[model samples]
Target chain A: GENVGLHLPTLSVQEGDNSIINCAYSNSASDYFIWYKQESGKGPQFIIDIRSNMDKRQGQRVTVLLNKTVKHLSLQIAATQPGDSAVYFCAEISDSSYKLIFGSGTRLLVRP
Target chain B: GAGVSQSPSNKVTEKGKDVELRCDPISGHTALYWYRQRLGQGLEFLIYFQGNSAPDKSGLPSDRFSAERTGESVSTLTIQRTQQEDSAVYLCASSRRPSGNSPLHFGNGTRLTVT
Candidate 1:
């Protein structure tokens, strides 16, 4: 079965450092990808997204890079902060369907 | 503007009991979705509603689970004869347009514990 998965279960980073989260997806048909952040006791919040045609997209202090050739996706956060600590998930969707398939999350722990 | 809202932030029910979870999407938003998250796991798509179109329920785990939406307003998810496996956090999200271009706004979600 096709699925999206993360490279690591947990990542510990010190404040003011750059943090990167990696994801691997098996479905070649997926055209849209998104990243979400879920804090404890809260629902996942939309972070950033990228289409298959584009390799990279940037938001406030965050960047999403897509490598379609390797079926890999990565999220980069600059100047990691305490507020950035959360569980991050990557989701993919194909044009033919409305379902957004999510990957197992990576827990980001920003140490002060 | 208010974001998506869900009722009964937490629920504890005994096995075999039925439960209904409610969701109120952002005003004027046309796309709504339901998802389930078990302990320490990513969300699992459950159902989707887009305007007058019939809902896409391909992700529903079983016949025991069902959902209903009125036009583009409130939606309810019903679980009948609930089992322990049904314990999870139910999240609701709304998008202003097709999620292909627009991002989804999610609610706090309802936490269900089946004993």
Candidate 2:
């Protein structure tokens, strides 16, 4: 079955440091990728997204890099903050369907 | 102006009982989605509705899980003969379109606990 998985289940980073979370997807037909942040007792919040046509996309203090050859995706957060600590999930959208398949999620713990 | 909203922020039911979760998408949004999140897990795609067209229920786990949407507005997910494994946070999200660029806005989700 097609699936998306993260390299780490949890990552701890110090405040003011850059943090990177990695994901690998199996489906070659997937064309769209997104990153979501979910806080305790809250729903997942969309952060940034990238299309197959582009290898990278940047948002406020956040960047998403997509590597098609290796089927890898990464989210980089600059100057990690305590409020940024949450469960981060990477989702992939197949070209044949609009359904979004989410990864296991990586918990980011920012040490202040 | 409001994001997606869901009913019964928390639900406590017993095994073999049936439960209904409701989702109200943002105004004028044509796409609605339902996802399940188990404890310490990621989101599980369940079902999706796009306008008046036939719903894409392919992601539904089993026949025990069912969902319906009226037009492009509200949707209801009904779990029949729920089991302990059904305990999880049921989330509803809505997007402007079914494309990849359109980001989904999610509701707080209904936390269900089957005893």
Candidate 3:
């Protein structure tokens, strides 16, 4: 089973603080990774992405870090805002496949 | 008009019935995908189409589930003899290509509730 999963089901953070979400994947052949944000009733929105060749990639207020050796992935959000409260998922794409394998997801709760 | 569009924002059907979900992808996009999301769950890959050619239907759950695309314009996912477990949101996404570099553009999705 090449499953991609997250370490925690939920995370709580204070406003203006940093939030880190962790994920682990079992497929070693995966070469591409992405982070998606999903609100209460909306589809997943692409946040950031990283390739196997690169260890890290940054977007507006988000960063995605990948460690191929440990099959680990993380999404870091800086200065968390109330609007950032949502479910975050890490999806990976195998070198041989076109479909993405998504993690269960981590629900982020921001407290003011 | 710029984003992917899915029809029947909400569907409520009885068990053993058949249902068809439609997806209208962004114009000129060659790649389209269908995914399922259960209540508070992760997205599950259903199927994907690269073009007018054959699609990758490996992610489909059972023999009762099938999908088809018409010349890269629209796609329909058909579920026969649907069960309660089939209740979920069916999402449609499209990308410029099937490559890794192209990010998927997702639609609002069709919420199907099988009672």
lDDT of 2 by residue, B1-85 (tens): 8889999899999999999999999998898999998888788888888885545788898999999888998899999999999
Which pairs of residues clash in candidate 1, taking residues 3 or more apart in a chain or in different chains?
none
Chain B TM-score against the true chain B, each candidate = 0.96, 0.96, 0.96
Q: Backbone clash tally for model 3?
A: 0
Q: What is candidate 3's DockQ?
A: 0.38
Q: TM-scores of the models, in the given order?
A: 0.93, 0.93, 0.93
- lDDT by residue (A1-112, candidate 2, tens digit) is 1111234388999999999999998788898999999887888899999999999999999999999999999999999999998889889996678798888889899999
lDDT of 3 by residue, A31-78 (tens): 888898887767788899899999988889898889999999999999
* Clashes by residue pair, model 3: none
Residue-level error in angstroms, candidate 3, position A72: 0.9
Least well predicted 10-residue stretch by lDDT in candidate 1 chain B: B51-60
